[model samples]
Target chain A: MAQVILKRIASGDKSAVQDCLKTYGGLIWSLARRMSPNPEEAEDAVQEIFIDIWKNAARFDETQASETTFVAMIARRRLIDRLRKINRQPNVDSLEDVLVEPTNDREQDLQVCVEAREAAAAMKNLRPEQRQILHLSIIQGFSHQEIADALKMPLGTVKTHARRGLIQVREFLGLGSDFEKEATV
Target chain B: MKDLQDNRLVELLADQSFFGLSAEEGMELGQLKKRFPEWENDFSLELTAAAIGLANLDVREDLPANLRAQVYANADEFFSEGATDQEVFNFAPSANKTIVSPPGASVAETTSGFSFWQNLGWAFAAVAGIALAVNIWTTRFEKPSEVVKNPETIQMPKPELTTAQKRDELLASAKDAVQISLTNPKNEKEIVGDMVWSNEKQRGYARFRGLPANDAAKETYQVWIVDETQDSKTPISGGVFDVDGSGEIIVPINAQLAVKKPKAVAITKEKVGGVVVSKQENVVAIAKV
Candidate 1:
């Protein structure tokens, strides 16, 4: 069997570091660049992200999520922490810069690709306003108030759309309804 | 009957997974999970769906070449330090079993040389002491399986060294390594590179120019160290990596086994995440060592 990079890294194989960077550099780099306020901050965040990965390499559970997903989770957690640390709200100008188009790359895992397609399809079932609100809140990293301000909607309406839209997506994916029924019983 | 309360709970769970929750909300989430174990699975699936949706953004961009160099240098320093620590505490017996006599101990106070048999007895005791120490140390701290299961216990503090300093250290260590220039067999002008390998040190670096970056989702570039000394025809794996841009890229060579006599190094395009044994049908470059 091909050696898992994280397993090798946990065993102190120095070369696995290079292999890891080569494998996930683009993903982390793009995430950091998009999330950070500037290129320099993105570069610094990338370094921190790698250090975190090395420290937590052994914790990676292959059965629960793909390596890409695991790494993405770490990257997002660090980026969000940084965002919160700075106490800066998501800029209105940057909202337009967020990439909204979905990719049809065949290289993604079949399961992930299918899930992404389903999520995208399920999103289309939402009202355009709810869909836009969720995209801003989830993908753009905007708070409910910031999204409301950006869209010129009432704060309560923003929260309503975000909550209702997310619940709809979860139901569409066939996840929340069963749990909800079971919980009430 | 799922009512307003149920809808509110679903919303809270979704928000918690997406952007994190406040302390009170987090406590509430814990209570909810404890009350309904099924909610945990539902939460995981929701998070997975959210991640998938985000992955569809296709926001990949090439990192700056200098940043890549810094990352490699930092990793090299970090792992090398770890190896040095392990060697000191875990490998060397003499270091672990230094014999120190108590103050005014009669055995060391006598300067006269002892008989050969007596010296041999002392040596055996020292060896036994080292063995016991090693056993206790390994059992206490170096359990590989435990480390894999709980990485938080082994995480070290980050080093404060600068990137340039780490890169300098890495290059200084590899200064005596041999360098071999690689060429693209099909089109020499299109892909070209060199590999710097130190057989004694069992480490090497590869630098390539003009090799186009691949879509890592579809394919990745795999490195192979062809050691003719090995009985098997299969070359030792040098690990799989991907290029992100058309410029020069420096990659560390990760040989899966000890390379006795490396005859050549080759790079091939393989499926994403790479392969155990490359078919070598799509060889991009080769360096005859």
Candidate 2:
């Protein structure tokens, strides 16, 4: 019901920058801290990410994705690029280390909150191994080899679980079949 | 109508939305979209599903107030310079320190009230000053021999070549190596690559030109060494790697087990690390030996 912060920033309102920081600074900082290897690097990355966000503000399409999702997408792109540049290897952590069962207390858009809740609920239905693979892939940003090393599972088994887990999650969200028809509009 | 091909397409879409689509898969996806527009919807849904999955991970911690102030100041400075917002990205922390300005100033009324000649002279002076400063800084702080002797002092190390470089080196030195083309059956010419291996050396390299850079977090392309002489049907694991960029990637063959009589080398899209045995459902390219 309110004008999106990105739209205001795109219109060259300097005050919107403050408003955006108040709203999403924590979200971006948390993500940067998680992705960056060190605090200084994280601080620098956060600065660059805000600059990127400013430049890309005009391109945000709320119809396609929520504001938080859009911001997350941009943040990940920058953070991942930094990660690749440094060739920093992440420690392989077992699935138990990463997966946090979603709680309903957080404040977010209703639709977004619903989707997150659905994904969390669906995760409960998955086999422990499948859930582990999904968590590593989705949350921790580990490659399959890292997962194999961390879990001591066969590489083939990891792929099987990843493929099956994603498919099952999609189904559980009621998006497996007839998903195309719902998405295009 | 929706069979194995549909399932494969769905898997490819999933990979594309979560990580990235390989160039070969991208081509296949493009064709599928053109032929079957409904596939676009499927792709969109998959992307949404990935975003939703990510939403569960959102746990926020407030940014330090100083960092927020820094961001606000940077943005204000960037906007106040009368330069377009996008130009702010051109300011690198290291290297040239020129503040970029908008082009096309009237010759008669240059800002700062400096005439053309004065501005030109000042620019030359600035360049000379910068050069002298750099020389002094480098000589005083970083002696070349000392830096070489004690590399740890450098805050940021130079980027090393990725695994692709190692693969390229292996291919370059391989003896008696044969080159074979990897082709897809559906779109044979569109998605193709070359694999060079030396049977005697028991080593090889795969050079794929069109594979998209994969998101290391989601999926990776796995190489398989098809050895028929081993008395087993399972292809030897040739290690796992992800494409970092679009264009030819030369990856060294890392065979888990020894390769006896070589039949062929195949590549399949697998989960990030790779799989022990491939189901072969998403074989992007195959180079027969």
lDDT of 1 at A111: 26
Clashing pairs in 2: A144-B273, A145-B273, A156-B276, B23-B212, B167-B252
Model 2: chain B TM-score relative to the native chain B: 0.41
TM-score of each predicted structure versus truth: 0.46, 0.45
Tens digits of lDDT, candidate 1, A46-137: 77788778877887766555566666767776666665554444223233323232223432442233445555667778897877777656
Q: Cα miss at B65, model 2 (Å)?
A: 2.8
Every candidate's DockQ is 0.10, 0.12
lDDT of 2 by residue, A19-83 (tens): 67767787677667655544455667787788788878888766555666666667766665565
B51-89 per-residue lDDT for model 2 (tens digits): 544554443346654455445534654454445453322
| DockQ, computed on Cα atoms, for candidate 2 | 0.12
Weakest 10 consecutive residues, lDDT, candidate 2 chain A? A102-111
After superposing candidate 2 on the true structure, give the runs of residues whose Cα lies further than 4 Å from its correct spot: A1-3, A10-14, A55-59, A86-112, A152-157, A167-185, B1-13, B16-60, B73-289
